[model samples]
Target chain A: MKKIQILGTGCPKCRKLTELAEKAADELGIAYELIKVTELDEIMRFGVMMTPGLAVDGEVKAAGRIPDVEEIKKMIA
Target chain B: MAECCGGGNRLVYACSGGADVGEIADRVARKLVKTGFARPSCLAGVGGHVPGFVASATGDVVNIVIDGCSVACALKTLEQVGADMTHFVLTDMGLKKGRTPVEDAVIDRIAETIRIKSSGRVEESPASTHDGCACGGC
Candidate 1:
């Protein structure tokens, strides 16, 4: 299963990104676990200073923004 | 921040980009509001030159601009519309730029930092609201 984590402080954009990620993953028929990261120390551990970021399978794939649906699909695939 | 009285309310606008830092900033803001630490304001309204948003951004209510990168999209948007705000930048918070893995612990740390800086309060653990997707019609 693919482990997908949305790194952020649970803001609106973060929620939107999570929604987009879930949709993309489901549509692609990918088995993934989505986690929301809302703490500060944990976020800094990833060396990320921005919210609404994405980590795929323990690797930081995107940071500081929400990726478009097509791009997210490609990332998971 | 004071509650939205009359036609104006305090708000927070995050530059939620495609990168990890951007995502983190966006999520932190939402979580803060949901948890009662802050309120999610209107970014589009400020960007669109809405008078209500602009007026609320001023005065006593706190207008926070959280930006994922130094590009400062959120701050710029508020600035363009003459909205005064307190700002936080992920890059300035000491997170290195570039693609990095997203970790729950890291996010916690970011939220904690904001909590400390803004009001010296740590966030309580989030409740098990739901595990379904936001698009699941919840």
Candidate 2:
């Protein structure tokens, strides 16, 4: 199963990003496990200073802003 | 030490998080740039690994990270990318992260601390040799 991680520091944008990611995943039938990376140390390991970031299988695909459902679907797809 | 600090290859980054101390950190960085203590630089670039920002941060210039609190956002951003840098945290400077006030006096003090820390370490320009090469290393 593919791993989808939302890297953030619990900021508002981070929360919104999570919702978007979950919505996208649900619609795509990706059969993926979604994890939210929240700790400062763990977030730092992803090297994202921005509030919200998206990672697929440990690879960062988008950061700093919320990508739309279609864009996120493409990223996870 | 020079009375006025200026004209160096220095890059500065500030966490600028939403907390009160984050405001202080951001202001201090801007003050350093306004006073010519260092060139204002971006944290996101280093975090994003943008080639230009990465190259600039790791170049021969001195790099400094000013973070709001122990969260060390600015410091970690540079450190994660392997960019050698010096850092200061507002909390370490005696300001509480959430309770600190973002005042002119506080900003000035932080900038001054940076100046004091930098005076002894500013790199001297390489001397030009008889062959007209200015490299510090022969």
Which is the leading candidate under TM-score? Answer: 2
In angstroms, the error of model 1 at A70 is 53
What lDDT score is found at residue B69 in candidate 1?
Answer: 90
Residue range A1-77, candidate 1, lDDT tens digits:
99998866665666888999999999999889999876645754554433456778866666545678888999888
Candidate 2 chain B — worst ten consecutive residues by lDDT sum?
B128-137
lDDT tens digits by residue: candidate 1, B37-79:
5545567665765433443354234566788899999999888
Interface RMSD of each: 14.4, 16.9
